[model samples]
Target: MRVRNRKGAPEMMAANTQYVVENPEAFKGKWAEKFGNDHPIHIEVGSGKGAFITGMAERHPDINYIAIDMQLTVLSYALDKVLEMNLSNVQLLHVDGSSLTNYFADGEVALVYLNFSDPWPKTRHEKRRLTYKDFLKTYETILVPHGKVHFKTDNRGLFEYSLASMSQYGMTLQQVWLDLHADTDFAGKNVMTEYEAKFSSKGQVIYRVEAQF
Candidate 1:
């Protein structure tokens, strides 16, 4: 993950969202039961500040969402958005994404969203990268047949690695685009995460792809 020199964000972000879960054990199973996690779940791993997940949840009411992020400050903002919107489909969690098995059952999720995931630019930190092969296998277990992982990143190396990892896992690349922002619809549809806003503003081209599970 590339650490920004700017550690904090706007005051609106903190005021925009609130922290919903402090612990995962008591809430995970019950929430899953309430929403029937087995029913077409789409998750956003490391959903920063919640704009994308909230927008997605609002758009797709039929599919349930379980958005996970490790940062309390960030998750707080996301939870508040869901609560403020009175959206029933979106669920927020503060947990280590690498420990996904603890919450989701086999063939539970329908899709995994990797929006601008940590680049882990250094070679030594490849394992820490979310799109690593180990993480793909974990996703495979949770997703049903034809389930997919929708990945979008501005980092070229991570995009290449993710594509290779997905292929190595026998997952098909259903669609891919090197310059997602070049597409008018994708660019106009601004689901404003702090990082997404910053990266795009700097004129970085976004890379996106969907891998079938």
Candidate 2:
């Protein structure tokens, strides 16, 4: 998502430093301390505009959520939603998903979410996919033992690639949904992201999976 820079967006995010952690690396393994509780930490890697992360934080008060995204413009928009909700269990991190280890210690995270990520479909760009082996390794290092990655996407190719990649990496596939929105039970419990809702309304098939590593 190429988010055009919005005027004063950076300034707005700067003013809300508490919700937007500008120096997340400083917290590192102290994320529990940052949240003022030892609650389980669950993070969304490309948490665009913060819908899923903030919604999860509101729904699950026992879990702390960190929204990680590289785009400042998107982070700014996400910061607004968090503030509007007065959500205390959420924080925004302006960083790339590749830098997960720099901000989290080994076995520090309980769950990781990858929602509507860029597929990087070209064969040559395979490594850029979030479910690529290298990225999975990073998730393994940061997540607790047997920690799970819950992923959702509307692209069939990406879903197939992710399932194959996770299986090749020796991760256990606990659940797989070929058409997530078609299942009434799962759809009701799912926190739909902006992209997911948009695509689903157009009758696109959404795929979801839970893989434990």
Query: What would the TM-scores of all predictions be?
Result: 0.83, 0.99
Model 1, poorest ten-residue lDDT window?
2-11
Q: Give the alpha carbon lDDT tens digit for every residue of 163-204 in model 2.
A: 999999999999999999889987668999999989999999
lDDT of each: 0.77, 0.94
Point to the candidate with the largest lDDT. Answer: 2
Write the residue-wise lDDT of candidate 1 on 71-116 in tens digits.
7667666766887899888777768999988877777678899998
TM-score, candidate number 2: 0.99
Question: Model 1: what TM-score?
Answer: 0.83
- Model 2 RMSD in angstroms: 0.6
